[model samples]
Target: MPRDTPYLQVADEIRARVLAGEWAVGDKLPSRARFAEEYGVGQSVAQRAMERLIIEGILEGRAGSGTYVRKARERRRMIRSRIHREGGGSPFRSALKDQGSAGTWECNSRARIPATEDIAARLAIEPGDFCVMTHYEFLADGQPAQLATSWEPMAITGGTDVLLPEMGPRGKIGVVARMRSIGVEISTAIEMPRPARATREQANFLGISVGDLVTQLERIYFDSEGRPVETADIIVPDIRWEIAYEIEVDDSRF
Candidate 1:
């Protein structure tokens, strides 16, 4: 076993007390100074212990409000697969279907936004080139569940029926269908997932604490001609979600 540090030891005791019902849901926890006094450790050690519990979803810190025990909710499962259902819908919708939960979302879009250096690289466009940007806040059972920002090159959808992702006559249809309408057959989507700490704004949007862990996916879609069509950054809170993947196996190996 790794050497137990002061913070972990302190955290273990606090977690035990919480599990033993020393504090009920919504109960305000002792201040860091009080915890240090009781644990006979430095205040920093006590703070670290509380932070550990916060990250574990046991405790939450609110500005101008004391830390309190958080209510427990089942972490929703979000599954990614090689196939999207025949028509259109987001992966969040697919995940909600598995949980028997209703999913809805709010989307706001802007056209002719300059592609940033990062987005430009992902979309094979030069920085400062124009793109249509869409921001999405997906909800499960009416609570915020995920956040996504997508960028599509205007050079591809300019003056087309699919100019705005969720607005035109055939809008709200997914990227594949929208792109297909413009004669771009989506052939591949690549996603790279990495662990991240939530920012203040992100924490506020997802109802999580700043510094709480999350999964960030850098995703891009390419057409049959191997040209990039769209790129997006997807954010999912780790405490509220369990991310999984369904891989399709080739039958020829047998």
Candidate 2:
């Protein structure tokens, strides 16, 4: 390695040690002084090399404790898109007409259950109100890509045409369209972004490591008067999807 590139070389060596299973998870690394002695370098040089790996999210340093390897990094990304709805009457089932090749939605029905305190707060319902849960798994290119669960008020959607297979829009159709069909005008949408590790259930569904990191998107939709219409939680694996946002500025005042 070149003289000025020693830190990177040291980092590469440590990474190899990790991949080769020489240093396992939770294993403490050699002290900085020991590493410097082993590599025939100053303590400052070894410390710098360790710092580089830490910044890359490969190593973690605990305050007052020695540095150690972090849990392996997982590859995941998120893509969030927003759309605005117009007009009064409900959109046709043919709104599916434009998205091409009708997307398939797998559905299952179960008994009403009480919402957690957080869920109840978000849905604006009683703390223990029972809810009808609808889960939809979306697939594209014949691969499982997204999973979503929607919660609806048991009393409102309990006996309507809302449960029909053809009720929503096309391509992972959201709850907003379904509400519109039933005269519920959704005027606001809230989406929460978070990084999470895949649960065993998610790992099996997405065909990834159990510890892999994934994106969790929780959303709440509201009617025009601000009553909660629906709430949904979606899990997206990192290997396949990403979230992008754009900012536009008008330079007229500049």
Candidate 3:
């Protein structure tokens, strides 16, 4: 069996203390030098142990202040459903409605941008194909809650009033409605979600620490003809939201 390193040993000891109620939630942890002297380890070792705990969500570091035991996060439920897509309008609007909070958003739309290989694959278009991309920052009750970047093939909306997602007659209406206005009937949407670490930019946008866990969702919408019409990548901070999928069971199964 592999033996525990000095830092791991120190981390385990500290974790035990926390679980034993030696330090309550929001209590400041000992400084690096103090921990080192207590554990008979180097200051670097003690610091590394604390960093591990921070990444594990057991502690948090405040700039210009010391590290403290992290409080339990209050997570709101984020439900994804066809009902929401049809009735709730935007994802941010739906999430806020579920939380009983008001939603506000900022968006920027870029038209006729060339799609990269990955985005082209998702849209089922050739690489370098022109696309309309919109970036969004969403807040609920004045707190940053979600970030999304949506891409649509220009082939579908080119020369249409809905080409720019945030402007024109059907602007800001949403994917299903906007496409319907353009004579396209959206029939299905597919979403895949996975856990990931937040990047520095994402952390800054979501107001969380870098390396904090987040939920990344890849969603694609298709028309009746099975052609990919739109796709988006959404980021939700794990500490702030818990995702729920509302899947309807087919009656024929019974």
Among the numbered candidates, top TM-score falls to 1
Residues 97-151, model 3: lDDT tens digits: 7768888889999998999999999999999999999999988898888899999
Off by over 4 Å in 2: 1-79, 84-103, 164-173, 245-254
lDDT of 2 by residue, 89-162 (tens): 22211232233423345766554778778889888888879887777776654556677787877766667767
TM-score against native, each model: 0.76, 0.57, 0.75
The reply for model 1, stretches above 4 Å from the true place, is 1-16, 20-72
On residues 108-136, what C-alpha lDDT tens digit does candidate 1 reach at each position?
99999999998999999999999999999
Residue 137 Cα positional deviation in candidate 3, in Å, after optimal superposition: 1.0
Model 3 spans > 4 angstroms off: 1-20, 23-71, 84-87
Candidate 2 lDDT for residue 89: 23
Candidate 2 TM-score, true structure as reference: 0.57
For model 2, name the residue pairs that clash: 76-238, 77-242, 78-242, 78-243, 79-242, 79-243
Pairs clashing within candidate 1: none
Model 2 Cα shift for residue 146 (angstroms):
1.5
Q: Please give the ranking of all candidate structures by TM-score, highest first, separated by commas.
A: 1, 3, 2
